[model samples]
Target: MLEIVPIRSDSRARARVKVRPPAFLGEPEPDTSVGQEISKAGVGIILCAGALIGLGGFLFFIGGLLTSGGITGFVKGWLTAFTGI
Candidate 1:
C-alpha cells in the first residue's frame, strides 16, 4: 500500500533566487595571468587600430589638400570642371 502526501497552497509566491551553483557543477580554476595577458593583448590591439586610423585620416587629409589646394581651391576646381570656365 502507498500513501499520497498533499502539498499546502500558500497565498504568496516563493522567492526564486539563484545564489549558488549546483553541487555537481565543477569550480573554476583561478588563473590571474591568463586574464592579465588577455587584457594586455586587447589593449595592444586597440592602440594599434587607433594609430592606424589616425595615420589613414592624416594621409587622406593631405591627399585632399594636394589634390585641390584647400577649401577655396576645391570650390574653384569644382566650378571650373562643371562650368568649363
Candidate 2:
C-alpha cells in the first residue's frame, strides 16, 4: 500500500514575487562607428549619382536632344519618327 502526501492550502500564500532585471541594464549603448557612417553615405551617394544619370538621360531623350545605345534609344527614335518632331 502506497500513501499519497497532501499539499497544504496555505502553501499558495507563500509564493514570492520575482523581480526581473532590465534586459538592457548591463549592455553598452549601440554606437554607429565612423566606418559604418561613411559606408552608408557612400551608398547614398552612389544611388543619387545613378538617379541623376538616369534623369539626365531621360530628359535628353524625351526632348529628342540626344541618342542612347539601348532599348530606350530605339523607343525614343520611334516616338520621334511617329510624332514628326
Candidate 3:
C-alpha cells in the first residue's frame, strides 16, 4: 500500500509541524447560487401550498353554503339580489 505523506523540510527527528488553517477558514465557500436557487424553489412551493389550502377552504365553505339544508333559500336570496326583487 502506498501511503502519501507530507515531506517535512526539517530533517530533525522532531520536526516542526505545519499548522493548517482552522476548519472555519478551510476551503472557499461553495457556490451560493445553488443554495439561493433551492431557497427560491422552496418559497415557491410554500406559496403554492398556501394557495392550494386557501382554495380548498374556499371550496369547502362554498360547498357548505350550497348544501340542501338551506340551498333553496340561498338561491332565492341571490335571485332577489340580482333582480332587485
Q: Model 1: per-residue lDDT, tens digit, 1-85?
A: 9999787686677798966644443333343467776787899999999999999999987787689979788778778989999
Candidate 2 per-residue lDDT, tens place, 1-85, comes to 9999999877755568987555585343356477876787899999999999999998876665444567678787788989998
Indicate whether candidate 1 or candidate 2 has the larger TM-score.
Answer: 1
Itemize residue pairs with steric clashes in candidate 3. none
What stretches of model 3 exceed 4 Å from their correct place? Answer: 1-32, 68-85
Residue pair clashes in candidate 1: none
lDDT of 1: 0.78
lDDT score for residue 35 of model 2: 81
The TM-score ranking, best first, is 1, 3, 2
Per-residue lDDT tens digits for candidate 3, residues 1-85, read 9999998888668568887654464243444466776787899999999999999999976876677357787677678889998
The RMSD of every model to the true structure, in order and in angstroms, is 11.8, 11.9, 11.7
TM-score against truth, every candidate = 0.46, 0.41, 0.43
80 Cα displacement, candidate 2 (Å):
13
C-alpha displacement of 68 in model 2, angstroms? 14
Q: Where does the lowest 10-residue lDDT sum fall in candidate 3?
A: 23-32
